[model samples]
Structure formats: structure tokens, C-alpha cells
Target: MPDYYISQISHTDKTVIQGVTALLNAEGIRLDANLDYTCGMYDDEMNIIATGSCFGNTLRCLAVSSEHQGEGLMNQIISHLIEVQFERGNTHLFLYTKCSSAKFFGDLGFYEIARIDEQIVFMENRRTGFKNYLKKLEESSALQLQTLTKDTSANTATLQSDNALPDTSTADRKIAALVMNANPFTLGHQYLVEKAARENDLLHLFIVSEDASLVPFKVRKQLVMEGTAHLDNICYHDSGPYIISNATFPSYFQKDENAVIESHAMLDLTVFTEIAQTLGINRRYVGEEPTSLVTGIYNNIMSEKLPENGIECIIVPRKTDGKKAISASTVRQAIKDNDVDTLKKLVPESTLRYFESKEAKEVIERIRNSGNVIHY
Candidate 1:
């Protein structure tokens, strides 16, 4: 047998795992083997010197005992875990570490994607092939340096001498704004996004990625990404539970009447104001739609409230046919009726192809037959 070997540990071995847990704790790292999908690196004596865990498909945690720090133990642990994750059909891996360790991971196969705080750095690895991974790390670091320079320049431009927003700079900032349930992205949504992108420096699309939505949040987010893959400065982010719940948008789920809708709108306005402040956004972009009373009310409230919060709201007019406005509801209706022509008109060719390939017609048929016309 090799002097150093990496293998999966069974749950029956939990008692022995306490050694690794203690080591991690001593290093100021927390590990819940029961919750986190864990792996470990043990010495010849079977004492774990290094341990790591995967949170989701994306995030991972790695900690090595300080006593064994200067050795190649950390590299072995990470390399072994990466190989295991790849074998298990994971294509991407992510981790968060102190900013001081950014160069350390970057020396490995990781590339920083974002920063959560002043201290933590979020890194990702997307390469599966060993040779490709090395090449990608080099290319990614170069690109990251360029991006960082541009980002710093942009940040400086947005800030005054005291690092506060000046009164003059507030009016020129444009934001792309939209509410996405992501039930199914239609051509109308794409049109709205294209138009919004043209007018805004940054697009902040609010995806209602909550459990209440019929389509799973991840799937919806994926659809949004697929639909808007071509746009620049367009980014996707979750609205979180607070913005999607009945407490914020009761009208979305039809839980409340006009009064609740108004209240919910007020909450959404407040939440969005805070979001804008955090993101350095000053202008909001919306799509034009006249059919839904809830949307009408939302637009009306936003028009009044956003300006008060120092955000200028701009509503983009929807693309129109000779007489009718394009909408997701119309596409859903066409899908129900098996009206291919109308569905084609309402959805982008790529989006229509995806649904058709997935046999979504059957699902739409069932929904129509059930007579449940609820929007999700």
C-alpha cells in the first residue's frame, strides 16, 4: 500500500473522526460531518492532519492542522477532494477563504469569483481535465487582474473624495430592474431585457427564487441565465425569501386583496431601496404591461416610491403585435391550446426549443385541463 492514501470514510467511523473534528476546531474551523459532505487526509498513524467538506455543488471548506501546515498535506487533501468531486460528476467547485489566502488558492487551481466581505474571498474551479485546469488557472488570474483594475476605476468614479455618493453623480446612474418568477422565460421577457440593457449601465434582475414558485428556484435561475446569455452587464441574483414572501408581494400569489397588495408593494419598495443603496444603483428599468391590475398597481407605487428613495424608475414599453402586447401569460395560454404559432410568437426560438425538447407540452396540457390559471 502507498504511504499516503485518500479514501472515503464510512459513517460507522464517526468515533475515529472526532480526532479530525478536534484538529479542525483547534484551527478555528467548524466542521459538521453530519451536515457537510466530508473528506479527510490521515497520516500513517491514521491521525487526520487535514479535512475538507462540500456544502453544495459549489462551496467547499478545507482546513489543515497548523502543525502540518508547511508540508504538502493541504495540496494532497484538496487535489484528492477535487478528483473525488469530478468522479462524482461535479464540474464546478467553490470555496471561501481569507483574503490573505487568495494568492495561495490562486497558486492552486482556484480563481476568485467574488468577495463576500473585506476578508473572505470566493473562488471557483471549472476545469475537469488536469492539463486544462492548470491552463485555466493561469488565464483566469490574468483576466482577474484586468477586471480588478477596471472595477477599481469604476468604483473610484462612483465615489466622491470622501468615498460618499455626490449629489451630481446620483442622476446619471442607470439600473436594469425586473421581477422574474421564471416559470418559463418567454420572448416578451427577452425583448424587455434587450431594451432594458441598451439603456442601463448595469442590469439588476431580481429573480424570485423562492420555494413558493411552482418551478424550482434553481431551474428558474438557469432559465433566466439561458435567456439572457447574450446581454452585457446583466447579472443574476436571488431576491431572497423576504422579497418573494407574501409579506412583500402578496399580489404575486394572490394571497391578498388591494390593501395587502398595497402593503406588500410598500415593503418591496423599501427592500428595493435598500438593495439599490447597497448596489450603488440610482435608476430602475421596468417593462411595460397594461393587462394585469397587480402590475399596474406595482408600477404606480414604484413610480411614486422609487424617486423618494433617490432611484429614478424608467418603464420600457413592451413589444407589440398589430393589436396585442406580448406576455408570458399569452404564451402559457398558447401552450395550453397547443397553438404552436402563437407560442412561437410569444417565446424565443431557443426557449421554445428547450420546452419542446423536454416534452413540456404535456405538462402545459395537464395544467390547462386542471383549469388552474394561477401565475407562478
Candidate 2:
């Protein structure tokens, strides 16, 4: 056993970073280039022995050299990444790892959220996220649920309940749902909502409650509410931390991490499926995305997973302006380039009204200055 030290790596440390990638690749784990921060452990010989990377609060690409395995190097790397995230102001954390490494992290206080069989597993440091969120949501509807708690070994979690329970039934309405970011509430969003609302007796429009977008959740929610004011059957609600949240939305830095996109989508869709059953929602409508990489993958996942979970996912063709699809990204780009004519066509008139207001003027300015915005 030789002395080992761990430290953060920079772009200049290309050799060490490459070594880290090699170590991970050798272990059948692909290095996610989308990592915002990276760190590595070095032996006394200055040889990289272990490494890991962090994408916001979600840790990824963690690996240890074969020679260094079983020496607890993986724990050290995970600890470093967790501390980095904490210093960067992230309290909750998510990690995706190969099935074999699940227990290694599970011992470090990570709890399983979802798993793709033997392929991959998504875990969170906060064991109660889904249970707590579900409890809160069901509580809002006055429905009681048994809460889940981490087991004593921290190896797994189990569900628990008090002696009391709320009514577990909901109205048997012909209900559907749609989750949207509505970054600026474009007409495409309005069209999708209208179609869903027309067919279903009630439509639950979930706005991504995380302020993870260029536009804050409050402003985005307001625009969505105003734009859909005509839909009497539609109900707008915040997505909260459970659905498409920081834990699951993987386009962490305005770019796609293609490898983990589906994994992230699974966690979101899983929670959504649970919520659907609770609200008597049978179908979910989403505008087909033709441009954005992240949302397109999410829609595809919705098409595949939701039905299997007993929820129908309807992918509506996005409303097009001539040959082009209307998108929040297009609206943001138009605003950035000051293309008023094109921006007006993409977004609804109500959304445009906000673009002219003093408050939105500032938002638009920040958006224009911000580089590479993700369209939820």
C-alpha cells in the first residue's frame, strides 16, 4: 500500500484526465464529456489511480484503477465530488453507476431511485425524495400514503406508514396531463394543451417547477397560465422537485449528456406515472420535438415507458410556422437576435406582451447574454 492523494484536475491536466477516462472505459463505463467538474486521485508516483466527475449535483464517470480496487479509492473519489457539489451549493445529489457498483455507493448514503435492469442504476443521497414528494402531492389532494425510509444498513430502503391513512380514491374524470417548461409559453404549448383539453374532461398542465431554465419558474408559469386562460378544463400546477427536476433533468449545462438521458428520463417518468394514477390521469400529451436533443429523447422515453406503466403518451406534432416547428428555443433565439417578426410568430400574443414589459425586458436581456440555453 503506497501513499495516495486526491485533487481536482483542470483542462491543463489533459494527460491525467485521459488516464481517468481510460480507467473508466476499461471498466465498461464511458466518460461523460459533459461533466462540469472533474477530480482524480493520484498515487505517490503521480499516477492516476481513481477519478470521478460531477455534473451539477449528479455524480458520474466514477472509476478506480484495477490495481487500486478494494483499497477504498472509490469512496475517496465520491467524497471529493460530493464536497465539490456542496461547496457549489447543491444539497441533494444523484449518481448513476453500473449495477455492480451500486452497493459501493449505497454504503456511502446513496439510495436507489430507478434501475434499468443490470445496465445502470440511478441513486440519490436523499432516500426520501420520491416518498416525501409523493406524500406532499397526495397530501395536497388529501390522500395519505405510506412513507419510505432508509433501512438500518443503508443498503436499501423500505416503505412505512402510520396507523392513519387518507382517502386513497380520486375522481373518475376523463383526465389527461402534459408537463411543460413553457420557458416563454409559445403557441405550440398552447396548441398541445388545447388538443389535450378538448379531448379530456380535465387536463393537468405541469410546469417544470425547477428554476433550472433561463426563465425562472414563476415567470414561465405565469406566461403559461395567461396563454392557456381560454382552456377552462385545463389546470396548471408546479412540477415541484419530483418531476423533471434537478435530480432528473440531465441537460445540466445547456448541453446533452447523451449517455444518461434515458436514465434520467426514467426517474422522471416513474414519478409521473405514480402521480397519474393518483390523479386518475390516463394519458399525457406532448408536442413532438424536431430540434432539441434533450426534449426529443424525453418524448421518445415517454412514448416507450408511460404506456408500459399504464399511462398513454400522446406525441402531438408540433405546430409549425410554414415549414419550421414553433419552439421556445426559436423564441429565445429570435429575442437574442432581435428578430421581432419571427419571435411574434413563435410565441403567443400574451407571451409577447411580457417581452415588452420592463420586467421581461430584463429577463430577455439576461437570456440574450446567456450562452447555449436549454429548452427543457
Candidate 3:
């Protein structure tokens, strides 16, 4: 065995943490900004030659020096981290590593979850890591459905609770899916849905059901359902915290541009593709974003990575409305600026009626008081 000892390093251990970070940084690794726990392999000289960390069951920032390669130190470091997670009642573990080193980890029983390119691959242990997550989500969804059904009579005017997708499968039809957050749905949103509906035999429109957006989830879903009612073959589904949310891809919301979009994108797309396979969706469609940097990066990631898994990615250009591109952000800006003419042009008739309703009066006033807006 090498003359080394592994030890836990607290976040406050600045000096020792710096030593480990130096090793990882020199190896060109992206550091996790937050860590629940960390472990380091120190040489007899007390230098951190290897280091690894765990962030919410995901093992991250594992690096072994080139000089120590082939010495079985990587396995040692990983075993320590996995045990750390195991002790915390987390049997399933996930990790991100380069594609080249994947085989090394694979030998240790970590299977590939998703890969962004030759440079990056996300892997998880085979012990119900992903399967458990799906089960938990389904249970939560079922409970919510029961609650909604029970309260429908009480809040008929306030709550519109009938958004459920058909699970009926048809192997002969070419099923396509479009995941979106039509926050107070706009004409551009309608155009994309219409295009996908026109091209595919069946289109699954998954409105991002996460309530993290500025617009409430109830309002957003209602707008989308009302606006797209014209499409007969389109089915409405909920995103269920699987796409572009803290549960999957949190970096999509953070302002830090230095964060790696690759890992977040891969992790989210991995879960999405699983659901896609279950639904027999072979095509994924997205609107070409010209303004939002974060959204654009996500679109590019899907375009590149989805194809590897046999899903065709279609990037549709935004539909223009004579003066400007018809977008949800444009609609929001119009609401903020009290530009009725622009809002009327940008949004669908359903969205317009919603804006006029007494139920929407508070949201409109809030938007008016809000500052200059940029959707990312």
C-alpha cells in the first residue's frame, strides 16, 4: 500500500482544503461550490495527492495525481466517498467523470447515466439510484392528483385542475415531445406547439410544472392549456421537477456563468430521455432562443447530446410578428411596460382574455411594478 492516509476535511479547513483544491484545479477539474462532505488522500509528506467529495449522494471532484496513477488510489478514494454517502442512508450514488476514465469507474460498478461528449460522462451506481428517484416522483405526483381531484368542487372558479396526459401508447405513431415553460403562453409558444403537432403523429407537450418561475404554476398551465386547445393530437403533460429545475439542472437558474453547463445538461437530459423512452418519443423539439444565454446553451446541449441516444432534435426558429420576435419574455415585458398594443400582438387570444380577467389583475399590477425584465 502507498504511504498515505485518508482523512475527512471540513469546509472550514481552509489550508488543507486549499491543498486538495490545488490538486483538483491543476488537473483541470471543475470544483463543486457546495459540498456536504469531503475526503482527501494525503501522502506521508502530508500533501493532498488525491481528493474526492460527495454532494447530496453525487460523488464529485475526484482527482488523483498523474504521478500516483495505476496505484489503485482512485478506487480507495471512491470507496471512502461512497461509504460516506452510504452511512448517511443514501445507498445510491452518482458521479461525473471524463469519458476516457469511465471504464476505470465502470470496473468499480458505476454505470453510465449520460454523456455530454468525449470529455464528460455522468455515472451512477446500479443500486436503484435512478429507479428510486423515479418512484418517489411518481408517488408524489399521485398524491397531488388525489388532492386536486378532491378539491375541484370547492375551487372551481379559482383552481382549474384537469391537466393530465394520456399514457396510451401507439407503436405505429411517430411520437414527439416538447418541454416548455409557457409562462403566460405567447404566440411564439403556440407556433412551436403547432409546428410539432403538424409534423408528428402525436405531440407530447410537457409544461414545466415547477412553481419556481415568476408566474405561478397554476396560471402558466392554464394559459398553455387554453391557448393550445386547437391542437387535437397534442397531449399535455407535467414536467414533474425533472427538467430545468433545482432537482435536475440548478445551474440553469444561477447567475454564475463560470459554472459547467455540461454536467447539469447531461444529468437533466438523462432523466428526460428515460421518460421519453417510456413514452415512445423519438423526436424532441425546441425553439431557437436568440436572447437568453442560459436557455441557448441548454438548447445546444440537447441538440448535441439527444442525437447520441437516437432522439432527433429539431430547433425551430422563433416566429416573428412584423415588429419583433413573438416570445414569452416579450409578452412579460409588454405587461411590465403597459404596452397593450405589443401585448395584444405577442400573446394568443386566450392569453389576452386571461390578462383582462379579474383573476389576473394582481399579476398584471405586480408585473407593472417590476423593473426591466430579462428571461434566462
TM-score of each: 0.52, 0.80, 0.59
Which candidate number maximizes TM-score?
2
RMSD of 3: 8.3
Give the TM-score (vs. native) of candidate 1.
Answer: 0.52
lDDT of each: 0.62, 0.74, 0.75
lDDT of 1 by residue, 79-189 (tens): 877777777787676665757777888888887644433445546674333234334433543454344345445666543332222232355656556666746677777
The candidates, ranked best first by TM-score, are 2, 3, 1
What lDDT, from 0 to 1, does candidate 1 have? 0.62
Please state the error at residue 99 of candidate 3 in Å: 12
Return the lDDT, model 3, position 75: 91
Model 2 score (lDDT): 0.74
Q: Which lDDT value does model 1 have at 37? A: 58
**Would you list the rank order by lDDT, best first?**
3, 2, 1
- For model 2, give the 10-residue run with minimal summed lDDT: 158-167
**Tens digits of lDDT, candidate 3, 255-323:** 356345655766678878887776667999999977867667878888998999989999999899986
Worst 10 residues of 3 by lDDT: 158-167
- Select the stronger candidate by lDDT from 1 and 3: 3
